[model samples]
Target: MTPSQNFFSDIHSIISQARQNAVRSVNFERVVMYWKIGQRIFEEEQNGEQRAEYGSFLIKTLAEALEPEFGTGFSARQLERFRQFYRTFPIASALRTEFSWTHYKLMLSIDNEDKRAFYEAESIHNLWNARELERQINSQLYERLLLSNDKKAVLAVAKKERLPEKAEHIIKDPMVLEFLGLKQESNYYEQDLESAIISHLQEFLLELGNGFAFVARQKRIHLDGDDFFIDLVFYNRLLQCFVLIEIKTHKLTHQDMGQLQMYVNYYDRVEKADFEKPTIGILLCADKNNTVVKFSLPEDNKQIIASKYELYLPSEKQLLEELEREINKEKD
Candidate 1:
């Protein structure tokens, strides 16, 4: 590539940066304005405690006045959202300027305070757009983490207050891969799914969870003149470990677990340096039976995981049901 000092390229880069910066400035102002509107409404509500109906009336009157002068952005519903936004983020100085009002609006739809705050912080850290934020929420990223970690601690990790220590803390079960666009049919080969994952590597990394950097696809290994391959290998910087992942197009079995364990052992013995954490192995399969997996690995095993993978994103209702089942099972 030519040096950026080349005339046309330099002009292009300068104009692009200027436009991007301008958009960010406008977005920051818009977000702050909404925050202030919420603050104003909150203050008014606080002062009118005597009138039970004042809150509703205040919003209606404000919307009526503002919508005509401004636009639909000030609709009563939108104003109420602004009010809730202020309530959620009481500290204006702490608001994340990296996100636009659109991102905050989507985040506000999450009713849980910790979950909302976690998503907000993660978006700023990950540089996710509104769509990506919505996707992570819809996919229950928080809930998935909550499965392997304490609620408070998981929220802390999401907020960057603390880092994950183990592979379990960052891995997602039944990983969502709707971006691959593969049909839900059972005829696809393992290589096909591996190829799709490689093709959509960025999306795959996002679904794989945080701090994951892809190492290789179908990483080859040889032992005693025989060859073997691992479908995917990722390194999690947060955990400081090699995550060796084997993809199975069908349900996972003991043989699969054994194979992955061997790969994990290989990496721990040969690939990783002395200062790095022990390698972790994951069997990413279409299906997993908990009883079989439990019996397959040693009772105290900490380095092997068998997680199911999904070809499509589940609907909200379906995700809720699955989450409830997981919660109940965990309780048991």
Candidate 2:
């Protein structure tokens, strides 16, 4: 590229950055304004011992007075949201400027305090927009992580208090792929799934969790006179290792685990650097049997993970069932 072209690119980037900053500043001001309004409303409500009826009447009166002058933004529903926002985040100083009011509004729906904190810390760490935050919440990311780890450990990793010592700390099981736009009933090849993931790579990364960077697709390896192709390949900075994912349209079997183990062995022997950790392999299948997986790998194995993929988001009932199953397995 010419020097003028490079200079123009730099100028364009600067303009974009400035515009983003302007938007952030406006959002921060709006969030603070709502917070203060909530604080005042709470303080007024606290004056009387019968806060239930009094608070309800106060909000209705305020809406009646304010909505007429200031428009629908001051409607009763909005005011209640503001009040709840303050209640949720009691300390004004604890509010994050990086989060928009929409972000907090979404989080306000989450009743679990630990779950809320995990999402808050993750949103700040990953710089998720309101949409991404909503998606993660809807997909039950916290619950999925909880399947393999405790609540405290999940929150600790998200808060960056300590780095993820292993891939399972960040990687989730039963990965959601609703954004891929593939219908659950549709018959598609492995390549189709791979293409869809590439097309929506940003969303895929979000679903894959943090610190992952795309490396290669259908990565080829040669041994002796034969050639082998691995599916999606990613490097996770948090784990400091290569993540090899192989998509299987059918249920996972012991043989499939061996194949992935071989691929992981190849990467660890040839591609892994002296400073990098052992390569991790993930068998992403449509279905998997926990018993088969357990007996297939070594007792101390940590490098290989088997994750099931769904074409769409699982319903609440389905997720609850899965959670119960995981809990039962842990007990055993």
Candidate 3:
């Protein structure tokens, strides 16, 4: 390279390295400061006889003092949160540098320790920002994981650093398709649905869960002079496989499964590299006959899957009933 090019490259490297160090230094300082603040506030609250009243007064007084000087972050509610943060994660050394104080603030709201830890570990591992962390938490990622896998598997997948074995580890069923904005009674063609999903691809990916990168929409595959267009194609880095999704506006049929199987086979035979795992096919339909799905695929089927989607969140009563039915089925 030219002298000028080398000089510029060196300057760029120096700037980049400096910026990274500055960020790390600032984050470490802030985490330490917050831990100390939390400790002080907690200790002051506990020292006096009117501890309960003092806790309330302490946050309010601190907020009053800090907000005018430091700005919007130090509201009474947030002060309380910082105190709770200290209570939840006592050790300053244990604070994750990957996340900011804002991220921890959001996590403190999660009542369940296990659920909070799972989100923390996953967020740090995935390098998620505060907003992404909040979205995943509000999206009920933990609940969806529980529904999809056994508790042991869920814990292992979320807590362990290793990638999960199957696509099911990261894929969520009955994925919330609220972003499509299609009303319950609105009639939409397959193309229309495809367009909606593409337009709202980011939200859809979030609902699809982690590690899915969009490869194509209306992805075409050619074989033996015939052309087939899969509705959606995604690559799951965690599973090390291609995911072929076929969208259906109506109840799933045997034909739908067969067609998805063909697409999966084509990908496995042609598109996939020797090092990549076998392709997975998912049928996203309005409804599915579980019995038919169980029997439709081969007895040893390990890739193809059919799952129903919902336009909006189901009612609490409906979810409870579904839970009860699942429990009863297991009992039988």
Candidate 4:
């Protein structure tokens, strides 16, 4: 590059850094202010003998007095959220500056403490914006993952201190693909799902979980005189392995599991580097029978998984039913 171009690029890079730094500073200050506000409100609430009565109208009175001077940001509802925020995160040091107040508010709505903490840590680790954090929570990402793991395991992921060591650690069954914009009645092919994922690859990766990067589509593997094509290939930095996904628009079958197993074996034997982990193969299909999946793979299988894919989030009732079923199955 020319010296002039180099000079311009340097200036632009510095400007970008400066802008991001300024935004971070502003967000940090904003969060600190909210924490202080919450602290003051709590202290005030406990100051008098009739604390219960004082607390009843404390927020409304504060909102009325503050909103007139400070603006609509201090609405009663928002003040209550601020109060709840302080109650939930009693320690000021626990609040992360990378997230905006919006992120905290969304997390505070969660009734489960473990779930809330997990989401908070994950938001920071993944650098998810408020919208992304909200989307993940609303999609029941925690509950879905819990279906595959125990409480300890679920919390460990949010901590980001533990990385995925096995296939189950990285795989989420009944993966939600609502972002693909496919209708329920539409007769879509596996290729259609593949194309949609490619188009919305960023959102797809978020749904896939952390540390996934698109590698290839229809990755070709030559066997003797024939060529075989794998549907989608992704490299997960966290797992240090390649994720080979095979899209099936029908219920998962043992044949599908066998085919994916062959692909995984081929990649592990031929494609993986000496330092990399074994390639993980996923067969994502429209439906999955737990019995079928259990019987299809070896008792100690970890390199391959068969999971269901959903074009939409299941309704709350449907999700509850599914969860109960999973619980019962575990008991059995």
Candidate 5:
């Protein structure tokens, strides 16, 4: 490239970065302004002996006086949100500058404290903007992770208190694929699903969880005279292992488990480095019987996991019901 072209490129990059920094500064200032407003409103409410009635009256009157001058940002509904925001995150020092006001607004709707904290930490860690964070929350990412893992461990990993030590802690079951834009009613082959995932690889990785870097597609391994292909391969830095995923258009069976196990064994013995952890094999199937999965693998097995994949996102009620059923089945 000519020196002139290089110079222009450098200047463009500088301007772009500067604009981004300016926007971030403005966004953080707005977050701080809202927090201060909420703090003042909360303090005023505490001063009144009848907190609930007085607080409602205070916000109503305050909005009436302020909205006309400052625009709709000071509306009664917004003021109430501000009040709730301050109450939700009481410590000013805990507020992360990386998070915009919109991020907090979305988080405020979450009733569970642990769930809220998980989203907060994940957003900061992943640099997720408002839209992505909203998508994950709506998709019920936290509840999905909680399905087969302990709550404290899940929170600990999400909050970066510790890295994930187990595949189940990070690999979500019944993976949501609404972003893939596939018709739920239509039948699809394994290759079609694989192609869709490749096309929407960024969203796929986000759905796959943290630290996953794509390695290969249709990875081929030669076993003696025959050749077999693995559907997808990913390396997860957080788990420090290779995650081999085999897509199945049908319900999972013992044969499917054995196939994944063989691929996992090959990866562990041949591909895995001495310092790296064991490879984890996931059977991403249309349906899976937990009882069949349980008996298919050895009692002490932790490397093989069967996860059901959905072409579309499931409602929170449906996910909760599925979790409840699984819990009861385990109890049996």
Candidate 6:
């Protein structure tokens, strides 16, 4: 490399490292400050004769006084959040530096303590940003993982002790494909859905869960003088594998599974590096027949997967029913 290139590369590396450290330090200090502020507010309120009135007035008064002098970040609502932050995580050392105040604010909105803790730990382990954290929480990632895996296994995976394997780790049921903007029961072409996904690619990536980086759409693979185009291709950093996705507008069939398998095999043999993990194939169809999927793939199949996708978010009732079914299947 040229000297200028080497200098720029080193500078970039230093800047990146410095930025990461700065973020961690700032978040850690801010959380510590908020916890102390909350504790102080709580103690003062307890000691005050008019506890209820005092608690209500204190934040408002503080915000009114501080906003004029200190500028932004001292709103009444935010002060209340700081107070709650202290209550939620009383220990300063327990606060995770991976998440910012915004992440904690979202977490505090969750009512269930156990669920809150799970998200918190998972966010820290996954290094998710505030938006990513919010998406996972909103999607009920913890509940879904619990439905699919044992409680112990779920906790372990959340803690990053045992990493999740296969498509199940990354795929969310009733996927929030609001990006597609296609109405359910409306006649839509596969090309239209693909176009929508491309248009709102960022949202689709977020919905696809963490670690997925978009590689291509309609990626062509050549084999034996024949060419086949895969609907989508993504690389999962966490799984260290290339994921080949096939979009189907109708119910999944054995032929769809076989096509995906063929694409996966081609990628594994030709495109994927020797050091990379096995390629994973997914058939994202409108519907899937579990029996067909099971019998279609080999008995010892480990690399290929098939899943159904939805154009819209499912109701909580539907999610719960699916969870129940998964639990029953696991038991059986």
TM-score: model 1 vs. ground truth: 0.93
TM-score of 5: 0.98
Per-residue lDDT over 1-332 for candidate 3, one digit per residue giving the tens place of the 0 to 100 score: 45798898999999999999899779877877877888889999998789898889888999999999988777887678778878999987788777787788788888888888889888876778888887677656676666556766766777775578777677776676766888877888878888999999888887776688999888888878999899999998878899999999999999999999999998999899999999999899988887788889998898988877777766545554655565676577
In model 4, which runs have C-alpha deviations exceeding 4 angstroms?
1-3
Q: Which scores better on lDDT, 1 or 2?
A: 2
The global C-alpha lDDT for each of the candidates, from Candidate 1 onward, is: 0.86, 0.93, 0.82, 0.87, 0.93, 0.79
| Per-residue alpha-carbon lDDT of candidate 2 for residues 1-332, written as tens digits (9 for 90 to 100) | 45798899999999999999999999999999999999999999999789999999999999999998999999999999999999999998998989999999999998989989999999999999999999898888888887788778899999999998777899898899999999998888889998999999999999999999999999999999999999999999999999999998889999999999999999999999999999999999999999999999999999999999987877767886898998999789
Write down the lDDT that model 4 would get.
0.87
Writing each residue's lDDT as its tens digit, candidate 5 over 157-268 gives: 9889998988999999889999989898888899999999999999999999999999999999999999999999999998999999999999999999999999999999
Give the lowest summed-lDDT range of ten residues in model 5.
1-10
lDDT of 4 by residue, 18-44 (tens): 999999889988988888898899999
Candidates ranked, most accurate by lDDT first: 5, 2, 4, 1, 3, 6
Judging by lDDT against the true structure, name the best candidate: 5
Tens-place lDDT per residue, model 1, 121-228, is 788778899889989988878876665667788777777887876677778877888899999885898899999999999998888878899988888989899999
Q: Tell me how far the alpha carbon of residue 174 in candidate 6 is from the true structure, in angstroms, after superposition.
A: 3.5
State the lDDT at 177 in candidate 4.
84
Q: Once all C-alphas are superposed, what RMSD does model 4 give against the true structure?
A: 1.9
TM-score of each: 0.93, 0.96, 0.80, 0.94, 0.98, 0.73
Model 3 is weakest, by summed lDDT over 10 consecutive residues, at 315-324
**Lowest lDDT 10-residue stretch of candidate 4:** 164-173
Estimate the overall C-alpha local distance difference test score of candidate 1.
0.86
Clashes of each: 0, 0, 0, 0, 0, 0
Q: Which residue pairs in candidate 5 have backbone atoms (N, alpha carbon, C) closer than 3 angstroms, thus clashing?
A: none
Q: Judged by lDDT against the true structure, how good is candidate 3?
A: 0.82
Between candidates 1 and 3, the TM-score winner: 1
Q: 1 or 3: which has the higher lDDT?
A: 1
